[model samples]
Target chain A: MFGLMTGQKIDRIPVSPFAMGYAAKVCGFSIGDFYANAKVNFRSQLMAADMHGYDSSPMYGYASIGAWEFGGKIGFPYEVGHGAPYVIEHPVETPEDVDRLEIPDPSRAGSNPISMEVAKQCNALGLPAVFQVGGFITFAGNIMEPARMLLWMIRKPELVHKVISKVLAFQKLTADWYIDTFGPEKCMVFSGGATESNKLISAKQFETFTLPNEIAINKYVLDKGIHSVLMHPCADQNANIPHYRKIREECGWRGRYVWNFGPETPLEKQIEMFGAHDIIGGNVDPPSFQTKSFDEVIMLCKDNIERGMKNPSGYILMPGCELPPLTPPINVHAMMTAARKFGSFE
Target chain B: MNEEILNGLADAVIAGDVEKAEKCAKDSISADMDAYTSIMEGCAKGMNVVSKKYECGETYVPEILCSAEAMNAAMDILKPHLKADATAVPKKIVLGVTKGDVHEIGKNLVKLMLEAAGFKVIDLGKDVPTEKFVAAVKEEDADICALSALMTTSMIFMPDVIREVKRVKPSIVTMVGGGPLSAATAETYGADGYAKDASVAVKVAKDLVRSV
Candidate 1:
């Protein structure tokens, strides 16, 4: 993956099989422990990575991270067929509640400490300590339920902005703690934007609510001498690309990143709009892992590799999002098999 | 004067103005307009336009939600004046986010549209179990049971709920929708209908009611 990132010649393209609960499900571990216990999540992901031979490392995070981190409650997966952890009650209910919120210590809040344990495990193995400061707007929504906050975009936008600012503060505090614990060179930042999908919110809302904080996060992370920053802009984000283009001038972009796309943004269009110089990955429909057979999975993966190999910078293959927990095991391996068989330059 | 009041109510809803919608509804009652026509012709008519605009990508969730609020506001003001015939034999539908999923945006949108279209929606809220759905169906004598799940892991439970509901009462229709599901998946699960989004869900439900 580093070889592809730095423009080095490689034997074949790398594959990042985005696994979370599928890791625990395959490794004979409990899904609840995977999210609640840091050691379990790291080990489960590492075991899955080893088994799949995918070019990735274990990272401790989940989509529902911010809710628990910011003084809310969540329920971790306890049984098979249950999804990832989810927030039970948002901390902020009414507009008045936003003023009453406070930022907790990153060292002790929610899973931040457990996340550090995963980072320690990574650092011990000579891998980068990855910190999850992704999803500012997602966290904001988690603090005050997504639907309520989304309505506030029209009804009470000031409340939404207030929550976002508080979230931004918490994010920076978390980043500062990670950088101090492990130097920037050894730390990788993982950020995502599932809530900002055009399916839910308009691109205009994305620019107003999510774009500035993301720009702030990128600048803060990159200026710290941290070279690695990979983003999985999940779901319908084709409309959000122009704002991304706008940030280059605002942030003095030191762009050497491989932006991951989903089924919404076609591989060709991302390459066309973002340019042919940076490493690009993904657009593999994630549900295919469960719904399609092995042969079908390979055909879909081979198509991704063939079209993705065109850009000069390079290509890596990955699931459009985290694989569904019960996705067939054979399909997980099919991505690597396709990469090995069809991704080679020779 | 009746046409003028009804048009005013529809225009307020289409414009997504809660204040105007309330005023229009109150004016319809002051002029003694039929309550059922005000809802079906005025408020629902405006929601239909909003749904079509959303289908064409001209508007989005924020605007759509506001429109729903405007229509709901008008309905609340006009509901008590409704005649016995308009309230008679409204079909009941039990809706929920299937167990293990907490996401409710999709389900909530569908519920709003269903209620606006005159269906008696029995909302079971999030992370609902299969047995609970069957119980609701039997308890309410529901005509349809709609299930939603946002994640693939949780989505696996859809067929279980569908099968159980059918075993208990073979005549009840089952509907499913969410991020991971398709029409093929719904059919495979023995669901009578599948809607990709909330707007389409209304049409599918109406069709399912007619077919049954």
Candidate 2:
């Protein structure tokens, strides 16, 4: 039976919705063993999730190279526990570089199949999983020269727009393909884009350069009548409460903005600011969880949940960013337990 | 010009009101006020206010950039008049985002602070390749070349940029900064200087130029 809740529909709000490699490691498995065998990885993560009372379980934490599978030579460690995938080599260097890069045929080449496989495994387990999708700018930008990407925004705005349009088309196409393959009603699409945050580019820049692509993607999903969630993980120094509010106002398409702490975003305040939204996720410091004891982790999770989960407005207990691969499994479970025990605000 | 025009110019620039800024600058010049005074005294003061607002978290990136744009417009109005024999208060530095890194907030901040502190900065913008950086140093005949990268993957290319600069002209001071960089890391990468913050970057630029 699905555990039921009133304040928000989540019967048991997901706890530790981050990379699961650390969980597998803490549960006593090798990294190679976990990646190769989803069952082992899933078992460890589910054990932690269930013990912690998590309603939903996370799949791989850092499959950033999902975009690189298109043709970019992404540096591997493929999942640096949960950090952004490193670009060992870029596929696009010049205008001609874009020519060499083809939007990866997801079902065929990269981690796309692995993700679908994991989703199926979760479905078979009678649990729900969110399919994570990467955005065009960060993925494509990373593969191209970084500085050039910014200049491209300035000098070759048209070219950058062309590439971004192509990338977004791929993202939407891939998401649709996943839904059609996996059955849309059974699957929820979780979209991610960090570059759209105000840290790297101004709101003007975001509006001019990033927002169009974002709007297009969100529109694509919304047009399908599918619930598409957006996770914008930016810790820009200029990222503040009002800016967060503005982004949500501008880009919120019945989905939510998953936030991270930055120089400007105080962890406690972010929870207060985002409490009104039904889909706010994060603010726990992963490093703290990695280093702290279960009790401290419990306290941290409890504090964030109390503030962040005031009313179901959909709360996801997660780290502010990538859950460092070294985080303790007990700590993660404790976080989940706290969320389960105390996420109600009726 | 009255305080209204001067203050308006400053406020318009800080507010990123380009039209109002241009109007204010032109009004003051037509009123027989020196364009350099309007710029250094009015526009610079406005920029300082915006920077302070930024420091206090009152403004975000869009606002800061808009303010920078307003200031830039004022600069455009005043540069022609001030171009004559402008004495270098501090040595000129060339700045850019490193190869493969498009993150530019920190780099832009450094550029503003360096200019505020009286150093001429030739910003090459973000994601600059090694060749462009090398060319910038030679073209500007800059005394220092500053580089920045936000991602660890891209920051790895910072050393290569520095290497190319040294290869072209080893005498040019090569500096690097960003979230992923550490002082130890900068030294390891053969950079002459490392700064963690924009204000500190200005001081470092001044110090590097002085020593050079």
Candidate 3:
């Protein structure tokens, strides 16, 4: 079981690129169809993942929906290549507004509930399922208005902390539910979003606001005897492995974890630095899945497999970020074919 | 403001202190200094330093937006005095988050920099309908409309906005910029120009406005 959870040895280093709404696009289904018909969506994802010999499958849930369901008016326009939905209208306007915010019912309101139900279905079907939990910082950033959040972080630091407290409370409520129902250790994996890519915020700001929350979540999840994967898909070329190591150590988690590496990530270097405990996944450019030929996809996946095999103890092959929405199914298949050919069960 | 005071303003901006920024600007103005020079030379100059810090990854959005608000407040006091001197407006541009897209960091940064450069910016808030953009163009009698969309899906709305603008006023130059947008994609969408960042957007907007 080459999964973020379980921490089991693999039959071979597996290929698992996150299907970020790409399943819908590749299957030519509407969002309504994708969400409404979980069985159909599940079949397509299983087919795509298996075609690639992928270790696991992923399904789409709106990143902003958790916050949006909690009274934030977030939305995504139906279109080609929108990627993920983001907050459009903020529900909270004043410091007093935090008083009015009610924790959203994850079983009812937004895609979180839909995703949870689907997770349950997937689990019952004996499919490995990863529940996408909002990163403490990113979710906090999304719930409040981005512009206003920025303003409030400075103009009202105390208020920002208060809002973050509420976000954490709500997030924990949902996370606790998932863990209790699914049994954290057996549930495929729990992934969270603390995108400390230096592109969006400074390393200092990341250290201050992002890292603490990430560390908190890591402890919370790991304390439950579950694994936590930190997704930092920011476009910061300057980010190094030492910071990641520091985060992992500071989080006090001795178990295995995965880092969602992106284009700028030096996988070999990171392997050298944090390979002892951290498993590096992704670095395949998402757009390449759309723009490249099947041969190119095969070569890319082969290269990743070869690289991972160089240190099979510390690598997971996958796309750098969420797979682009327009990624071709053939490319995905080719990636799986290559992985099966070159992978080892070390 | 003296070098110490200017440094304080710089520190305030870096720390995102609006009140200290306002107080520093007022104190400098009361000290028999030219308001424009005090602003352009004092506060705006400090912000440019902060912007460099931001570029170098020394500051984040919270700090930057707060600093921008400080600059905005200081500018409010200094704008009237500059108007008395018949100050030049670098460009007159209309800006908005494109229809169906609402992420505003890049757009807001572009607006901040444009305003910092003395452009009269008409900022239509997020989720702007195409008609609102067109109406703003006609009403503001704007020279350029700068559109932004953070998501690739919402980037489709940029072209619709350009078409709406051209359909009503063919001569109006429309510039689109965002994470998902590139010059090639912008050309594919029939945009007049594209910028990858705020400074680039400022330059493009200035050039487009000047040429138009």
lDDT by residue (tens digit), candidate 1, A121-179: 99999787988875666778888998888888898999999999888888889889999
Could you say which candidate leads in lDDT?
1
Instruction: Estimate the lDDT of model 3.
Output: 0.67
Off by over 4 Å in 2: A1-14, A28-44, A50-53, A61-67, A78-84, A99-101, A228-230, A237-277, A291-299, A333-346, B1-212
Question: Which scores greater on lDDT, model 1 or model 2?
Answer: 1
Q: How do the candidates rank by lDDT, highest first? A: 1, 3, 2
- Cα deviation of A115 in candidate 2 (Å)? 2.3
Docking class of 1: medium
**Across residues A203-257, which tens digit of lDDT does each residue of candidate 2 receive?**
5665566666666666566566555454545455243345445545655535534
Query: Per-residue lDDT tens digits of candidate 2, residues B1-212?
Result: 46788899888977778889888877887787767667767887787777666555455554666677777887787667664555445587889987655457689888986775567889898668778988988887888999887655457677788898888887899888876567877888899999975646866777887787
Cα error of candidate 1 at position B72, Å: 2.2
In the order shown, the chain A TM-scores of the predictions are 0.96, 0.79, 0.85
The order by descending DockQ is 1, 3, 2
Error of 2 at A303 (Å): 3.4
Each model's lDDT comes to: 0.85, 0.64, 0.67
Model 3 bad stretches (over 4 Å) = A1-13, A32-44, A47-55, A76-83, A88-91, A99-110, A227-243, A250-253, A288-309, A328-346, B1-15, B27-39, B128-145, B156-176, B181-194, B203-212
- DockQ of each model vs. true complex: 0.70, 0.09, 0.37
TM-score of each: 0.97, 0.60, 0.82
State the DockQ, from 0 to 1, for candidate 1: 0.70
List where candidate 1 sits over 4 angstroms from the true fold.
none
- Look at candidate 2 and tell me the lDDT of residue A304: 78
